[model samples]
Target chain A: MHPLDEALQMQQQDPGLYTAATHPGYANAVGPFGGITAAQLLQAALLHPQRLGEPISQTVHFAAPVNEGEFVINAQPVRTNRSTQHWLIQASQDGHMVAMATAVFAKRRDTWSGVDATFPHNLPDPQSVAPMQWQKRPEFTNRYDLRYFDGVIPHELSGQERPHGQSSLWVRDEPPRPLDFAALASICDVFFPRIMIRRQRWVMIGTITLTSYFHADSALLTQVGSDYVLGVARAQVYRDGYFDQSAEVWSAKGDLLATTHQMVYFKD
Target chain B: MHPLDEALQMQQQDPGLYTAATHPGYANAVGPFGGITAAQLLQAALLHPQRLGEPISQTVHFAAPVNEGEFVINAQPVRTNRSTQHWLIQASQDGHMVAMATAVFAKRRDTWSGVDATFPHNLPDPQSVAPMQWQKRPEFTNRYDLRYFDGVIPHELSGQERPHGQSSLWVRDEPPRPLDFAALASICDVFFPRIMIRRQRWVMIGTITLTSYFHADSALLTQVGSDYVLGVARAQVYRDGYFDQSAEVWSAKGDLLATTHQMVYFKD
Candidate 1:
């Protein structure tokens, strides 16, 4: 199996309870990559026996860093309507809280369609852009292929130009696995901290909370396959040691797949 | 006392539980206004004894319609750090879940500040714009004074122009109440459903999940006491019985106060 798949492996001990171990390949400085953790939490619901349908919206809050070891997940479907469902999930290690999340899933139906937000246009294709090559990066960075159009990490920039904290890039898994909701959720957090772009330097930063809204369904994901998805992210405000990052993920065919927003805690 | 205040009144039943009733003044088609319900969910945390700081991000998922009676809210601060806290809340009537939410709060500190979002400019002041008056609207509509610069409800429009589902307006309490986190949160949902602007007609639409990120502190709220806040909202995509609405609420002083995003279910 691929490393990403191994990283997300879960063993159901009983209903609403599962045990999983952290993969060193996906480990961050403190624990596993937030995206994978988020994906793992999401998987709890997706793998639930009573789950209603595909996830429409999900919010994950990181209370503390996860310790490198086996963690337990308690995911419960609090309510199930005829057409929608609500869930709550938590990750804990040694009986201590690490992260919690809430998710909404719904059965989709045919309806009138429209698109109001403008898609990023006139960008170079993924094949034309060179993938980022970095040394001394987090282990998780090596699990994905990232080709940037702008907003490269501050350490890689060698100039006096100050960016406005915006990045547009094409991203996908390193081994090229098929696209799924879990993969999409993980991809949403691929942007480097916006502070790195604005201040032209790195700082102590961690995502306190992240939310992603899914716009595509199973059919759409199947069409996306193993292709790269374009991701665009920008910071809106950095005040009082907290900043907000908003991002949009688009398929290679120019379809909006998901939109995500996150708030990060930073030390200047 | 104001109806909104009365609607938000919570009686502590225990450490992590409270009881509140739906207010007729803020009634929607079946239940109370979504904004008021969201505010009430947030108040459960703000009123909690263990809450550490102001809310930085919150997500509310509507599992079912809340009935017009007293409902129970179970809010618990699952984890608390030195400067941050995580919360989980559930609102139910007669032991059935109606809504659930999660929130992140942080005690802030001074840091490097920057704003990358552009506030809407060249707009008429609140004093110059006429307030909207409607006779057959939901009761919640009367609780606020709304002056639309554009993107008025389709029922009020009398032209052949097609809108891209966007609205820019000034909004405040009907009797002018002091600004706070709850009021700001309620205002985040003040924009009418984007479907009304996109299809140029009213449809059966309801928000399924709403997430709001607060950027203002108590000091900023105090500075804009009882003043109108500019609210701008737009739809990104409406497809397969669901659409996403993104909004930014700004102080009259051109400061971005909060940004909210929601996914709504609609029938065309």
Candidate 2:
């Protein structure tokens, strides 16, 4: 199994109870990368027997630092409607909660479809853009092939003031894995905190909460294959040591695949 | 007290257990307004003794239709850090969950603060604009003083094929209450569904998941007082009978008060 798959793999200890081992490959400054934990929480819902369909929306709260070891995830289908299902998933280590999330899934049907927001234009091909050099950064950064299109890359920010906290880039799984909902969830957090980009300073920061809206279906994700997807993220406001970042993930053909928003807590 | 306040008012029967009455003025087509429910859920957290600071982020899942009448709310402080707290709140009728929500609160500290996203430019003042006619809409609409700057008002779609799902308006509480977190939470859902604006068809639509990030603190909110705040909402994509809407609430002075995103289930 791919390392990410292995990290996300869960054993069904009992119905609605699963256990997962933390993988060191995706380690951040703290515990495991938040992205992987998010994907794992969503995975629990996806693996549920009562799951209705694909995930429509998910919000994950990083309540505490997850320790590196075996963790238990309990996913409960809180409510199941004819067309949609709501799930509550929590990750606990040593009998203490570390993360909690809620997911909404629905069996989508054909309907009037359109993209209102235009895909960002004029981006260099992923092949032409060079991958970010990661030597002393978080181990998780090595798991993704990232090509920056604009904005200050992490660790490269000098005390420069940027007009806005915006970053556009092309990113995909480093080992070139096929695109899927789990991978998409991970990609949403790939954008380094907007504060790090804007102030050109790498401060202690963590995402307090994240919400992702999946706009692509399985077919669309499959069609994209292992190609890179363009991502654009910008901060609306940075105040009181917290900022809100909004992002969009688009297919190579400019199809909007997902949009995510999060609030980050930073120590200045 | 205003009907909204009455509707949201909860009596603490016991620690973490509260009882609330549903006010008819906030009724939607089927149940109490989702916004009101969201506010009440947050209110529960606010009233919690262990609650810290203000709400930084909140996501509420409408699991089932909330029937009118008395309801019970249970709020729990899931995790509390030195500066931040995580809460899980649920609303039930007769012991069955109707809505579930997670909220993050933090004692904000002064830091480098700025608004990256400019307040939308060239908008008419709220006074110059006329309030939307709500004679035949949801009873909740009557609670807001709304002035549309663009997009087709709900129920007034004239079958025009607009390029995108976008709406810009100035809104305030109907009784002209001072801005607060709960009131701001309610205002976040004031915009009609983007599909209704883009296709000019009033389809059966409901918000399944809604997440709001508060950018302004109580001081800023109080400073804005009862003045109208500009709201802009747009959809990135609408497909498979579901669409996602992103919106921003900005003070007339251009301070971004809140940003919200939601996934809505709709019938074409």
Give the range where candidate 2 chain B is weakest over 10 consecutive residues by summed lDDT. Answer: B152-161
lDDT of 2 by residue, A37-124 (tens): 8899998888888788899888999999998889999999999999999999998999899999999999999988888988876778
Backbone clash pairs for candidate 1 read: none
Q: What is the interface RMSD of candidate 1, in Å?
A: 1.1
lDDT agreement with native, every candidate:
0.88, 0.88
Kindly list the per-residue Cα lDDT of model 1 for residues A10-85, writing each as its tens digit.
9999887999888898888778899999889998888888889899888999989898889999999988888888
Error of 1 at A157 (Å): 4.7
lDDT of 2: 0.88
Residue A218 in model 2: lDDT: 91
Estimated TM-score per prediction?
A: 0.97, 0.98
Tens-digit lDDT track for model 2 on B97-191? 99999999999998878778877788897899878764358898889888987884644557777899898999998889988899998888888
